[model samples]
Target: MDDDIRRGDLVAEGEPEQEFNPGIAARLPRKTVAGGALVRDEAGRILFLEPTYKPTLDIPGGIAEYDESPYEACVREVQEEIGLALPIGPLLVVDWVPALGVWSDALAFVFDGGILDQPTIDRLVLDPSEARAHYFLTLEEAAPRLRPSMARRLARALQALTTSRPTYTDFGR
Candidate 1:
């Protein structure tokens, strides 16, 4: 087999090595993406979902599927997990979660879900299989229920709401 002979495969034998190799794509940074809704009730309490699959409490959201935008994923997850077709609002927080044990680094987004009325909260239809329960709590009250980074993210999201700007953070810190 000559080096110049064409053997069509993953890499062609006849092709000279180029500066930009196909392997560059694999070496490029690949980060996970997720979206969450910073839903709030009229009492200024944040809506936090107790996802059955998650060890700790999380907002109504999940990882973005292939071909789906983070906003779309957030909207879909909210409806699927909480049975609410609420119009998602502006992006509040874009948190860059650091890679943890057995977990890849991720870019997590938080969108404003605006304040829901009492009746709307009452009408929330949570699927027992997806979430065992839900809670509406102040940041102080909710911090204990979430992982430290998430608690920070939530706090930053709330701050973004007040400031009318989105925040970027390193693992929500």
Candidate 2:
């Protein structure tokens, strides 16, 4: 309505100009995505990796890289952790873990690596830098060794394996 105003102008008088600020978006909470595989031996024991950097034992997986899908990351991580290049099966579990202290919330995925043959198990290799040792342990034996969160996730994952369906958990429960 004023002489200085131009036609088709989006801003109205007395209204603050608005712009999309990436800084504000960057401040929003982001969940880290990770993928791993649940592999088993002929005796029906799950395979666990003992990471060199962490005092805790972890599954055969790692954090997903930028622009990498969860499934792809699973395959890559499995190969990196233990020199295996087997095809990864369908996703079995998706666990949303809450933030604890300095760590951020994370969405972790588990894929079915299927049962390994005796020959494959015998040929398995472990990278000393990534994994110090690998073991095949029954569910009962592995429970106490795994962190509480991982234990719950493994339980749900085993249930998924039995039911032949995918399972989801919040905070590893």
Tens-digit lDDT string for candidate 2 (1-173): 23245333535554655648847766888789999999999888999998998787788988988867788789888998888897888888999998888989999999998899989988888988899899999877988878789989988888898899998999678
What's the lDDT for residue 4 in model 1?
38
What is the alpha-carbon lDDT of model 1 when measured against the actual structure? Answer: 0.88
Question: Mind giving the per-residue lDDT tens digits that candidate 1 earns over 1-173?
Answer: 23333245327545666757668876888789998999999889989888888778888988999856789889889998889899999999999998999889999999998899998998899989889999998989977778999999998999999999998999888
Q: State TM-scores per candidate.
A: 0.85, 0.85
Question: What TM-score quantifies how close candidate 1 is to the native fold?
Answer: 0.85
Residue 146 lDDT (model 2): 81
Worst lDDT window (10 residues) for model 1?
1-10
Clashing pairs for model 2 are none
**Model 1 clashing residue pairs (backbone):** none
